[model samples]
Target: MAKLWILLLLVCVFAGAQPPERSKAPKVWDEKALAEWATPIAGLNVRPSHIRPKEYYDLPVVSLRTYPVYAPGREPAGYWQRIQSTGPKPLMEKKGSRTATEWIEAGKIAFEEADFFHLRTLDPKYIAEVRNGSLAPSRVLPDGTLFGLRWVPTKQGVALSSSNCSFCHTLYLPDGARVPGAPFRTIAPRPPETFKVWPVFSRLQVELGVLVGSPPFLMPGLSVGARLSQGYGVPWKSDDPHERLKTVTQEEYEQLDLAARSSGGLPRWNGSIIFPAKTPDLIGIQERRYIDHTATHLHRNAGDLMRYAALVTSAEATRFGPHEMGGPDTKRIRARFSDDDLYALARYLYSLTPPANPNPFNESAAAGQRLFQREGCVNCHTPPLYTNNRLTLASGFAVPANAPASLEILPVSVGTDPSLALSTRKGTGYYKIPSLKGVWYRGRYLHDGSLASLEEMFDPSRLQDSHSPGGWRPLGTKTRAVKGHEFGLGLTPAERSQLIAFLRTL
Candidate 1:
């Protein structure tokens, strides 16, 4: 056999002279090595390779990813701009140094004494003693006593680790004073005096209320309805076709279209819009690098809050809920946060910002901002801060051939609408590209609020195909189905009210 063909041509010339297999690849960690490994844990660090997760979640993700890209108001001429060019306290504070106005009045008196709702009590036997790990969700002291007198640290019932932003952004501390809650009304219920839950607007619910100072029409839907009630560990059986979904029966809507054409329907979240879904306002989320609302983890701060407090809390929070975090003061609220109060509540939520640019250039919003950049939409809406943040796929989404290798996916640019990621429960068509900057009071919009306004989002008969709860729906004649970034479609009705007067000045 020709000596086995001369030993297979000398093993194919020693595998093509050996030098070509050098691409062991895998190095992609840009932004100058993630700003030198996030400068000692992101205290104003920024370097996710100098912007582009839609400008690093609409700007300032740790001083623009760990400093040095100056320009827009440069930053050199000294004395911190001659002490902020003679300031009164807004060169990022320090004029009269009342020690940064006494840590902003001791963070508004520790956000009004940890928003004291009788210091924390949900009791329906604390959801079956957090599903039998045996009762524990502490922080009590207004007489009912408990602020660490102990219990809550279960391993598979829920709550063993918490940097405590009111155990997942639902704060109010009323008799204590912090206010903000809406997501499926955990209480505080009573605000609809014309409080539009939708009617149009969503560049990701106004970039998640400009990266988390959120208020005007709040969001975070009770921490995504406490992450779908701790990832559906109970509820569901109202007759089970995924919780008796409002009057089915056409043979259970043909067995929910054969269970959404087999295996990709119930990861869920729109629980009547997560019981009102609000409470997120972690005062500018560590200078907005990104977290949830599908913006996943692009350069997130606090090591993505210690990987969502070790995967959203103890005993691997049962792979994210349906029970875990032990009960009975789970070892005294894990000894009342001492990692310097979890880096001072992530440095008071990365020093929150947003109350400044209240409507800067309006000539009927500059003719609806030249018909919103002559309708090509400045290519994913670019500007000082309109949105180029990046993540596409809204048109007719269908990418899920079993996604989740920790979802590094992308690709959906051709006119986005994808019938609610092929009809919901997060059917992985990938999302995240958000940010527009407080579109004049954020309201119900996509990521499942469905659409509500911006003039029914340019009504081309609400994008046909018989609109059901499929996607865009929000405002009334009741069929919303519209999906991702479809910016002011085919205008004209005074250019959709001058692009809603240039999105009410962002």
Candidate 2:
């Protein structure tokens, strides 16, 4: 027995003596891959600007998950929910809408059912079972939604519409257009996709279907539509995944992608929304200075939430009331909603949070930070929250031109009253500044996503007279370029590289 024990011990000792193998830790970006990404966009100041002192915005912070999947109190709701909870108070009511208790009581009814997770699974039978004015929680069109694309439910008809919104607005890639004097054109191997964790380059292209290849402005999904149709319009011809991205003319591309601009000669297209953009991700939306493409401001408050819901979901187009965009189908939906239901949605929207992760504290990125301040990118995108949260005509884009001349007559932002502007082509002067929190996760960067990658944003060649055909293409493009954040016009390639490294750490 002693001899057998000795032999076993010797075997164990020999096994332990074998060298321990080292395991590789997962990297967000492989060093080489990150370098490649930064190479083309060299010299842009991507580091967070430190010129301003960090003044924390006291926005509400809430947990994102809820029990029973989407229960109101257990898991905090997102901005979409909070925006809808304002209920049916008149936008100009002196006394405001309802008591806190009253809202919650009614909100519970709305909250119980007016959730996407819940609605996505509802049986058609359940939808049919609800009687008008039922007031019962489960029976109250529990699956009602403003539109699949919106972050929070709104009274706007387009907000409730599906696929169309997502296709036009979210996940956009730049058309590769350039600013008046930029030096580089935005270039990328693929189209934009939502950013998750990374090995980034290859993984983004292969698995998540980040867009790859030409007509840089085209969204990958839309490219898919074009390839399938073989030059036809949306509702593409085929479902074959491989055959969906053939090159086509810009007009042809838009034809397949955008809703018709002028259907049978009316002012609007058959399927277009006033704002055809996709509802952005809400993970860090509380930090944005602005809310809509029009730059409609929504501070993190209950009153703004109420107005958003009532204006977007309510059936009537009464000045401040909801505007239905879904034809006859929407009229039926609006009839079913009440003020209390709106409150639930508002409650949900105000409760959003950025996705969780510890700050990377990348040392290499520190060099980039210095560059950011040196380059003056800090004026608009001030940090740690990363925005001044102020509105300016800079984002007005073409909206002012397209609007009636009366809008031009109004004093720019502060001088004009919002109420009057609400009724006219132009009214409000305030354009909310968006927060830069979580900018890394979004692609088709910028409010319009005109640029394909960050690289195109900084190239000086993009700013030349030959580049931008119609002034600066802020969203970015292929032919012209999206100028960099105007930081580091004098940066050397090596320093620019370090700066990009720091940006990735954010």
Candidate 3:
């Protein structure tokens, strides 16, 4: 009995219970939350409003887990029959009395098992095809479950959910280990070369404009023009590159996706195909002050985190200023997550820890640590959390003198690509200074994921026009300069090695 009690105590410590952090769990779908759900688009400084609470609560609640998808021949005997016979599983139920550790455990399950808001489907055939890219037996986890695809049960029926936080956040190491919440992992089966992805995955209402780059307000069928306009068009910018998407052919759209995919970037809604932002590492998200590469939302508290999940999932607003994204189709509230479910998710995200650091603190790393300090990388990326949690200006962006005091701005430009800052709907005129806590696990760098490695990031050759990008660039393009964030480019080969050694240890 004492040992069992000790084991329970250890579990709570690992969970990092912080009940006081959230004064009291706020009703996630409250009118007050909807009001401040979105931080306005940066330059225009206009917040996009969302659907009313009545509309949000009117939708059905989802608390189901998707069954694990195994490889083609790896399924246990009678497993399919067992899962099919099983009824809907209510994943999280609010209990009158429960420990904080219990809440976090529930959140962890939802984080890994919950189907993405925009990617659920009842089709069985398409679920099997989601693993087409991973034909080898070695591609799956130790338990033989495929990385992302799952068979989720809903009131409608047994459905194959396409993506989850694990889809983008998991780094599938070659040795069969996965680091959940690490950046730049694409486990979803790629759309066909023709760019005609699983059309069945998105039934009329089973998608989000921000998530899949389709039109938000799809009433009848929409043209690629309407889809692109809703997903990437900035009516505020007269010379918006997305305006040309109206005339863009299917082949052209395919090329754009391929280009973005090659470098581990995707043009999410309100973001641009030409200026895609990299998927963020969620391992240390609890320490972050802002969300999105452009700092479009403030990470004030657990309620805000809960709201973010709800926003990206189903409540995204497509309107800005006087311009409407979809002329014919009105904005719709697709689905909603319960307050307890979202709160659980927030706690789970907060409790995530980095995988064990393989790189040791050696003499080289110690010298490199000194170099890191001397180089003044600490101003933006302060230690402990390894980030000051402030927003830095991008070049060519005029900082509004009357900007809100709540926004902590460093006013220093790294001179990176400002297109994601200026042209996209997510543009906040500032980029959130990212933490360097787990760069060793992070395979990609920069706002657009332009570099593939720390060695490549500091390579002066990357600044030259003839240099090839180690990471993703345009599909067929050969060479282009990866400009900006020129720090550590002047280091000698030995010093560079030491610097990277120190960075990996973090």
Candidate 4:
């Protein structure tokens, strides 16, 4: 028995304790691969260009750790004083990342730690304003940290910065729990009026606008009208709406933006202010076949996700054919994450879990499930992951003979408005049929987020111009018809309720 016990001890000691080995990550910034990754836009038939791999990799890798911003009076004692004096600190080193679990943890740190805009506030007065509740990003974490803001200590001073992924992607529930990778509810961005007391932070906001709100502008020196002109126009296409931006003054541009920039939709780089895309929920991005609403890029693997992270952050070429948006003065300083950091971020994003469904799959949901099948929703939504994972053509686009065979294009358009699919810099003339796996948790509906609720989506009244949309609308739009996706509209009130109940349970 002593010998047997000794043998068992030896067996336990020698056996390995680790997860299954991870495959070597593919090289994400391959020029040849990037050239072929995106689907070309419809009318112009030109693919959005990307910067050379050298341009991407040459940027300095900054992996500084970010600190949480506490609401007024809620921060731990001495948190403010300690952080103010400290210099920037690196979040992690590659030497410590051996196992998948370790890499994922590092990735989470990288995700939460990286900051885009460094609003330098050298004086103690800036901190006082933050603590006094005069200035704070709206969404608050349960611990009282502002969800969208981070305090980043630099060599000069503590700067206010936006948290990397969590700023836009995190969803806060009524119970005070946070769901990472869920879509964020936007609080109206603070107008410049609030920034009068903090001049440094306000100036930084203008400089940072080149990276955040108006990233498509290659040069920061141009007037708002010129920047707008260069930022969003499809040069090759004669009918591009962005052409008008060249003639507008700064005040005119502001007026246009005031109306175009709605709550659910904000114009992104290569995205149109007139046809802004809604923020996507990143919870199940691993299961997706394409990226973006227009199926702009193929989601080939983790490498692709990493490449996307790089492209969005700093690598965009802004070169569609011969046109360079910023002209010759496009040079600027930009930050990058190491390839390993990006790989870990992709892995962490893939690992995001959907929250448990509070809606029980009882009789009502079951009946709705039957109705779902009877209405043939199964053809598109499917089961399990709840998406068919196919691309559907927009109303105006005709599939070209050269369309990649790899994409499962469902030739028929859903008859939805085709403006976003046809007009934007990112437009590819197709919209991926979205998955309904977490429909219950999604606060907005439609690619542009025109509807606020599932109930609002099913209401036939929404098709009329008199209907007041429950969600986002263009600036001047008080009432406008929300068209298309006419499915499930014919169902009775009780039937629609049942269907919604079943959808929530998903």
Candidate 5:
């Protein structure tokens, strides 16, 4: 009878060890259903102002071959030759399997391999500079992995490549394991050495644009630069060199300088703003109804993600201008890919799964979970998904009357820095309640990448006037308090540590 009881106990333990059943929720976006739902919302005289143009919907049946064009009247630079010879090729061919899975596989290849931004043109120069010690190697994380940029091999030679979505969303751990769809924390520090490469590269780009003999209207940077200069009150074509100096105050000039420096050595066509947003994780993105920190892009369906990818990679400057101004460029770029390709890309992105948590639940973590619930953190970051997916208004941004009523636009402010939401083109007067599911891998918390770690977030020192400078705070702003998201501030140190541990397990 004792032996029989032991066997039954073992069976019960085995049953308890089995993983819980996952919810059978639909992962893919249903465009028709979304449209049907939106129809009634639209009839109420509230419409989403940022809808993609009709040309986006009418994509080509197959991928088209596209090449980078240089500035007119300039000879082909050595950089152009290196890029043409060694740059990574597009994954989408003229002919391939049209199945959804195959397309997703193709998209995965593209995500890992494609240089959609044409950043690889400077690869040869960058390699030579690093090898010759003219440029310092990018800082490696504690895990011995360089996060910002990596090189991949091509047919001709090695290609210095920037990330696609995979670079931003993937995390490499100390154990030499990679977690796809995790928020990448180990961004390379912006060394001053990297700035030297830009002037040379920009000159080469202009020369190439001239040599390619593209019409002035077709020149890549000209119109965008002009538009940006006008918007920022800089005179790109000013006869007087000191025209900007006369109009702008010293403080305003300094602010502009600070903003420009915030781009971190990237070639930014648009003038920078006070605070740029952190890259969001793609894990469980299908469950997210809104896109971006500002909730500027409404993610009603997979096509919306596709549209977003297309716009960001190519014509992001278009967002600042009227639709008519950027219509031609948008249409031309949209024509390169088919509806199926976009759908497949979205599918591949949605398919990303967060890595398994190596940390097991313990007494401390269990206590922390209780604290998480007790402190009202669950109110905004609700569970199952860990985000209510609602839009909370920033302090200064006023919601327009024409704004869609379907969105959950809340009135309360979280008291975090509102500069990005109030100032940038991506601003829609709202910030999305981000999910906390994979908080273990994410760093530099908050919308603007202000707080470096969960501990710093809970640190009461952040409320003090002499708060230490870190994250993206400029040198002058060091003593400025990092305010807002005061949920865990009142917790005891032990409780805070427990709360952090519990957050890591999520």
Candidate 6:
């Protein structure tokens, strides 16, 4: 009996000592693989011009101290200097061979650390001062850790401070709960004075001969400032150089101003042709077959998301490049980041889940769910993932006959604004039908963010030229009509309320 027990114990020990089964690693793509995988569902007939070789121009050597800066509630310069004296810690810690789960973990870190927008305009000292608590607690969560911004270590101690994808996507609730992959709701419109700062800086840069060009002029910044100022009910200065350099015509600006005031919110970008944009929630993005408001990029798989991340980050300079181009350009960048990094990032993004809804379905919400299907909302915002993952043509965009069927262009127009699909670099002559999941947490509805709430969307007064009694009015204009997506305007007040309740449950 003792010998038999001993034999069984030995067998157990040997089994435990053997290596555990390992999960398969996520697939990493090489350049060739990525190109083949991302082959446009439809071949693009309208190819952009070939990039010319970069010309080296002499840039002015300017002292950092000469720059005038302002951060509303920042600490004195000496405090920042003191912190900088201590070397910055590395943003990412080293890890071993990455499994699928490990890739997700690494991807989360990358999402927080990566700077895709190239918005490194602020002095590092200012960022440090503001982050260290001179500014409001808007960016900090209940845990006392920062949410969107981070101070990364550079070779010259800790000079780089950047905003990542989380800056716009992460939402901090009113009760101090922090939710990742949610659309930001607390962002207040920038004051007119705040908009004035960047133009001053850009003018200085041009005067110092630091930047010499026309197409790449700091127009994006200037446009944003003008849009913000107009949204804030501030008068536009006709003689302002920033206003004069704008791509948007005076009539377009007037329409934008009217739209902003009517919605009581900022207007989203009319493609790149206008200013501002609706910040999209990142939850459940993995299921999306297309990306961007205009559905410019058909997301066949995770690699597409990684390509986007690369284009937005350190590789942004290559967007309209003379040499290496990775994004929309024909040529690829000279130095490409490892496919593993993007794979990890995509895995992490795919892992994100929406926060659990505190509100459960009630009798009214159940009725609303039935209405949701009956009202034709289910056609575009389909069930399960809540999107058909197809593109709808803008009201006026004429689809080319040679356009490939793989592009999945729908014949119907939802009557939404067509400018974003017609005018911007991202315009594909179609607008992607957006998923309705998490619509409850989102605000300033529609592609342009022209409506502030779901209730406001059904308001009949929105279709009229004059402001409605209880409806939201744009900041500057008295008589502005909010048109498009007029599906549920006929719903009774109680039905609308119930529908909104059901939407929150999504």
Estimate the TM-score of every prediction: 0.26, 0.41, 0.87, 0.89, 0.67, 0.68
**Per-residue lDDT of model 1, residues 212-276, tens digit only:** 11111222333332322332322322322233333333343323322221111112222122112
Give the poorly placed runs of model 5, Cα more than 4 Å off.
1-90, 93-101, 120-163, 174-176, 187-271, 315-340
Residue 52 miss distance in model 3 (angstroms): 2.8
Per-residue CA lDDT of model 4 for 280-308, tens digit only, reads 88999999999999988999889889988
Model 3 poorest 10 in a row by lDDT = 186-195
What lDDT tens digits, residue by residue, belong to model 2 across residues 453-491?
445444455455456422213122325444333455457
Best by lDDT: 4
- On TM-score, the candidate that comes out on top is 4
Per-residue CA lDDT of model 6 for 342-459, tens digit only, reads 6667878899988777767998899889889889899888899888988888787667876655577678888876655554434566778888888776765777666667777777
Off by over 4 Å in 3: 1-24, 33-37, 94-97, 124-142, 186-220, 330-333
The TM-score-based order of candidates, best leading, equals: 4, 3, 6, 5, 2, 1
Model 3 per-residue lDDT tens digits across residues 153-246: 6667777765566666677655657777776453433312212333444342334333254323443456555667667889888788778887
**Which is better, 2 or 5, measured by TM-score?**
5
Clashing pairs in 4: 259-475
How many residue pairs clash (N, CA or C atoms closer than 3 angstroms) in each of the candidate models, in the order given?
60, 83, 1, 1, 11, 7
lDDT string, candidate 5, 1-506, tens digits: 99999999999999999765422113222344333232111111222223343434443332322222222223245734665565544446534335555656766665554443343444566556533444333443444433344444455565454445565566666565776666554443332233333333334444333111011112344433332333222222134222333355434543443433332322122213335566578888899988777776678877677765654444233332222223233223223344444556677888888888877789999999999899998988899888888988787656666666767876788888776555444445678899988877776678866666789889999888788735556435656688877788999999999999998988
Give the lDDT of residue 258 in candidate 4. Answer: 45
Model 5 weakest 10-residue run by lDDT: 209-218
lDDT ranking from best candidate downward: 4, 3, 5, 6, 1, 2
